[model samples]
Target: MSEQTFFATAPAGVELLLAAELVELGAATAQAARGGILFRGPLELGYRACLWSRTASRVLLPLAEFPAADAEALYAGIHDLPWENHLAPDGTLSIEFNGSGPGIDHSHYGAQRVKDAIVDRFRARCGERPSIDSRQPDLRIHAHWRNGQVTVSLDLSGDSLHRRGYREATVTAPLKETLAAALLLKAGWPAIAAAGGPLIDPLCGSGTLIIEAAWMAGDHAPGLLRSHWGFSGWLGHVPALWNRLLAEADERCAVGQSRIPPLFASDHDSKAVRATLINTGRAGVADRVRVERREWATVKPPPGPPGLLIANPPYGERMGETDDVSALYIQLGERLKSHFGGWRAALFTGAPELGKRMGLRAHKTNVFYNGPLECRLLQFRVEPEFFVDRDAADRHARAAALNRAISDGADGFINRLRKNLRHLGRWAEREGVSCYRIYDADLPEYAVAIDRYEQWLHVQEYAPPSSIDPARAQQRLEQVIAVLPAVLELPPDQVVLKVRQRQKGASQYQKQAEQGRFHEVHEGPARLLVNFTDYLDTGLFLDHRLTRQLLREQATGRRFLNLFGYTGTATVHAALGGATSTTTVDLSATYLDWARRNLELNGIHGSQHQLIRADCRQWLTRTLDRYDLIFLDPPTFSNSRQLTESFDIQRDQVELLRQTLRLLAPGGVLIFSTNHRKFRLEVAALADIHLEDWSRRTLPPDFARDPKIHRCWRITQS
Candidate 1:
């Protein structure tokens, strides 16, 4: 047995930073390499690396390197290696193959060849082979093949180092553990925390930044939380030394004084506060970090000489297809400019629109790619009178930089949604089939509207912090939403309040649509009762605007059917679209009544629409009406008895398709649709009917990025 060299991986762009960290932790001449630093040392150094190095992803020990021209050569090279040296009879192993040559074009196939070589080597000698555990493999064999040369090494990190095992709970947009450490490193929070200042994150999504600060400030090692390290099962392992190192790291930490220096996190969400609290506790930093639920307006700048005020705010685009949070960002800048004077802050965001919303020029911006998105961390120097510059050149330079860096990996929630929304929106528009955007673009909300298609990005919405003064935050949210269009230059008619609807008594004849050009609007064939003012919105949902239009085109001379027909907009469109008769179904009594009123307002008689008050799916099964053209749009996932029957588009789509297909007449179409964001159709299973995907073709210009807001399939027997 011999002690050899190893390389621990760090994320890209942070290799030099990690190298510096390794050298500072007392490693011998750490040289910065590709993924991480390369350092030659004893067993003690590897243990120290696990305990002390905060930036390293995983450490790997290279067992052998051989030149192979083909698959047979690769197998022979791996088969000859001593596989039992690293593993006992009970040891389990997993293999990861990274290929870059034509000899092994398929990664899985290459990995299989390597696995066969290893098992053959073991079985020929000992008549037994190791088990494979993809999740918790004791010895992970990592193979890197470049230009027909294969290098196989045992991964020392049993699992990804990002699995800190400390985050108890997380809200939407939780930062990866490795990424959190890197962002803090870039922001230079360690030096500031050590120099006697509180480490603060105003929009701490999952307490990652604050916990990282506490760990750094207290001199705590991150690897202490994880019980298993890849080196622990290796040759010449030192359990005593590892425990001692952990103990020493623990002894070295001290509680940060509340007044001297502290770690603080704030957000305007209550659920996020709970998540942060749980996360901090799991991280063993709950006592050290203080979290608050606060709106930006209520938040005070750091006390005691104005320390760092780093915020990863909502840019309104990354996580979902919505950019309505522009006003929130602009308001954030106003707050920081007025309240957080004499403070140095770093704003990590992926959206350039957010920087413009701040209405303040950034001092420095760093370009970093968060996956596919090219994001930036904009630095700002705030003083008593925040930068009131006098130049066009600076503005032009800033604009150019902002345009160049359109993506962000802020680890904070705000920009994630902004980026997602932008990507989804752009995708839909390019396909030229937009109906209505499913974004909550209330300016104050910093959203357009989120659709099922946009939900494919899985953008998370933060549960508001517990400490937010609801009255103040709500008022601020409304004000920001109301004033957003002035700067955006979008028509008020184009911008609708996405409000929740509730039922009312018969005596309460609520004022819905009144006299104005807005009072009555027409969509080709159907007349709509449009109300742009009062409350968050009117009866019409623009996302379904195109769906309604499609229903109108398919309604001519057929017995039209509308299920889950909220307010009967589709029904009215069907009747006016020249349908012989329309049947509408819903569980809401008020909505059914409202639907009737809407038709009456448009001079279309209620007799034309047979309004049935019952659960749509239940009504479908019980009724004997075989319609020529049926519009069956079910919720992505609904548990309510109204349409429930455990509706899931991805899982039950085939069954529902079969059901809808039964209702269509020969040569007639059944438009089967579901708004489930992640719904994927199995075209082969539904081969009985001809399927035409009309999602992109039916979209409106505003909601073009995520065309699958809900997939519209026209199925008819050819």
Candidate 2:
């Protein structure tokens, strides 16, 4: 057999593991590449990899490489390839094209072009083209374009090796099979399994990890369970060689199964346990692998020496989940310390900090990408020597110091907070509100505003003056974090902390985190998605609660427009208020998507509700569309590069109001608001326009505690 170059795809962090597996499988050379591995070897090496490599998602053999600067060139280049030599003209195939350079930007379009070239070539030669089969295709072709060069390959390991012909069903956040294999390999499970020690996955969700471990221990080829391979349909496939390999695999599987060590799997969810059983049975390891429906808190070690106790536990990636599972990690740590003392534990999680909460030091940690989330596989030797409590004690001591310092002002702050919550909670309940401010710097030392959104809390620490010690300020903030959860009867993780510095311009809109988690909260008749952790401010403005209500109440059968519509909460209120139509304008695509989701959540969508992604200032200047009612809430200062110029509300309010007034219909009310603490309405500059201060009346009861929360005014050009 001649030497051939091949590529094997793996999940982001498992690329190196896949490369190692390839090297072990007798590849002449294997090197890690982004999302996969590149290697050079004989054709048999490729076949062996496709059959046995556990970490590889796909095995690809390059068929052709050519310059494809444009779609036309891509089509011509692909069409010139000897398609008939790879697949029968009557066979079905699917084309997967990725990457782009100058002219090609869309993957779907690129895939279509490649598909057209293949079919056109066959049609021209044999007067018949292969049928397109997206599902269960006879052949799979992958195209990669980079820097005006395209590499077209034949996918020998069809339908990602992670499928493994198992997993009839799955629960939420199911671990991909290949990733499970990678984690097991990284944890040195193979050597442990060979020692005849029992393996356990107490938090197994669908048993991907356990099954992969079982196969590794038994020396059963991971590909034995798969029913289809891209090479099966290829004209060039050496069936005799493949069958010989399959026979050898079967013989090895029989011996491996007999030598397999005990495997135990358990989960709190019965559905997950059942799923594991079904999947393991399909993988031909059901009899060897025992699964039980058991919670992590009570899961005991298997009745033998511990091999590897590995699990892909629920990693609380989102805010709500983080709060919900913080205690789970703590409990898991306690379990490891008390029960699984001699076992080596490999725990995979998104938030590595949560692992610290487990109170055990990790002996080794490997970074892996589980989908879009970068995760850590923490390897721990669950021994008495590793269970040091010094870190925990120090953490407690510092928290205690901060608590003591904050106690100096805690009495006044807590009393003020309770007073407001009592009065405002009653008012909010009576008014059907789920989100409202509970405390707004009631004590100067506790210069933070706390808002309750249903069960979650958003705490914004106001940047203190330079005269205040930074250390003291941080201590106070930490104290607030420690006490607020207990005071609010919520989990400590439920309290999202943010520093609210005076944002000069558009810096406030810059993402602080990319959690992409949004919580739906109610304000009167509308439902809005309020994100507490991703920005300096929550998507829904607590201070503007009453103002949004007013907009809803007065917007019936009127055309409504919301400027600077952060997350489009106000638009939802207006639409709920029976606004005939609404247009929401904002500069951030993130906020626009949020607004769209908000409207969709409330079932308020279609052409009647429009979301525009543009600087509100620029849009207002050129708009011919007039609204019967308008709500303009400009930022205090915004120098977003998207805008033609920087915006300062105080300096540009007159011009902005004038432009807005021109778009207002007769008798239409244009409501403007700002959060600038010292903002003043330029009454004289807009004397010709009808203006009235609604600042006092629009203040929600919760916001009244802080008089400088916001300012509002009603303007009309009548």
Candidate 3:
């Protein structure tokens, strides 16, 4: 057979790894390109590449590459290809377009033209044409144009390989599958596992790394378990050859009872352990891996010598968004240098500044894209002679840093951990709360987060050690957690540690309650009813307690308007606090009902209370009604099916907050609140109103976490 070429694309940064995978999979020869790998091989080799290649995001069989300076030329070039060889007359095909090029302004138009060309070509010859199925088509085609050259290829993987189909549930932050495989491959796990070191990921986190490592180390193909392969639907697909290829894979993957790996994984959260088990099973590697529910500090490496430890820790980036990332990173570095020795390690993180807190040096580092965020996969080597360094210092320093983080300095080491804790400790002690949580719960590298919901603080406990070496990341979390209670003054019962979870069912526990319904029953709180049953958030925001109270004190006998009313907790507060009348407007009927209940529960009655269901943004445009006071607090982001469209606070805050201004009566106050941590109020933009930020002073005694939980702006347009 003549030499045949194929293109394999990956989420940026894996092009080289995909090329490497192709070369090992028996490609005639492979070369790395901009966003994909190009190789020449036989039909069986192509099947094997699609079956076993873990690093490649999608495999594409190019049909043609030509120049199209304009849309007409682009259409003609794609229409001229042999679409019949790839798609059957009765088959369904879909098209996708990528890359920026001149003359082609719209990508959807490009895809449509190609689709039209293919369907027209088939119709011209057979008098009938294949159907178009964008959702799950028999064929997925990619159109790429760079400069004046256009390359069209068959999208051999219908969906992304990241859809491994094993995730039973995903928590706030779960690492993408493709990124996980790339991180492991970059960590040199294949070489280390193949050379005899036990492979373990103590912070397994949704089992992405554990499963990826198992497949690579076991020489098991990732795409094997997939019931469907893109090429299987192609016109030239050979059933006999496909079955034979699968049989060979089964033979190769049939591990002997003794030759299997000693993979160990642990997390303080039981839920994470369960999630890991289900994901592993879905990936077909459950029986080969042992998972445990244990804290990072207490996680014991399997009896064998330290091998390869890989972890994707929270960088306070994607999964976590607290400014305390520096402190967490410092603790992680101290733990690795103290606990892990004689081990090769790799960690993926987004916060570059926190890397300085690791204290130890990284040997090799590479950048990879994790979704829209740019992340770093850093590798470090540790010997058995490693000893305690930072953790050996003062107990108060460690505790304070862990419990409370400081955000003052911006120097070498950035000191995100020590500094945060010192300042946090001062605030906690001053406020008399024995236990307070300080953390970086958001940003780019945040692949995991510690949710302090319901007065319960959950820690990811991965990044602290990842700063140095992942060989001992969990050990560090365990050690730090052992002393955490002493600093936070939190009892054993109050502490609820959540491990990394993946795959959550809609039928399972509801993340939030109905938009306007007040179903969240209050377990505690003397002033107002607190509920999370009807919304994504429980009604009472501990951080905004003072602000809510402030509204009630000033609401006496006044008519108040609550825009984006949520649970109408403020209305209930105003009613109880002596407001004469309360009118609430929101987009969700579910929330409107909740607000009504909150008012009813507080002993406030009838005619004085009004609940109007409307998108506060659009409804406010025509209304002339005004109130003595207005309370506005909209969500930071939402994809509510009830609404006609989605809303993002990052882009819509200033405009939304400005909308609330029109509803406030002269001399009446508009108490606006936004949980977006980075909100800056755009004070100059609102020239007609006077704005005063009450975030720091409004933090109440019972809620002693970070002061930036919600920025409160008292707006009055005189």
Q: Considering every candidate listed, which one attains the maximal lDDT?
A: 2
Candidates by lDDT, descending order: 2, 3, 1
Per-residue lDDT over 499-615 for candidate 3, one digit per residue giving the tens place of the 0 to 100 score = 434312221124432323222333223234443233334455556656667888899878888887877877777777788898899876756776776777767778879999987
Once fitted onto the true fold, the runs of candidate 3 whose alpha carbons sit more than 4 angstroms away are: 100-103, 256-258, 315-328, 384-718
Candidate 1 local accuracy as lDDT? 0.66
lDDT of 2: 0.85
Which parts of model 1 are misplaced by more than 4 Å? 1-4, 100-103, 254-260, 315-323, 384-718
RMSD of 1: 16.6
| CA lDDT, candidate 2, residue 44 | 84
Best by TM-score: 2
Candidate 1 structure quality by residue, lDDT tens digits, 138-241: 67889988876788988776777777888888876676677667777777777777778666787887887778777776777777788887756655366787
lDDT winner between candidates 1 and 2 = 2
lDDT of each: 0.66, 0.85, 0.68
Name the regions of candidate 2 deviating beyond 4 angstroms: 315-324, 390-439, 442-447, 451-494, 498-718
Model 1: ten consecutive residues of lowest lDDT: 453-462
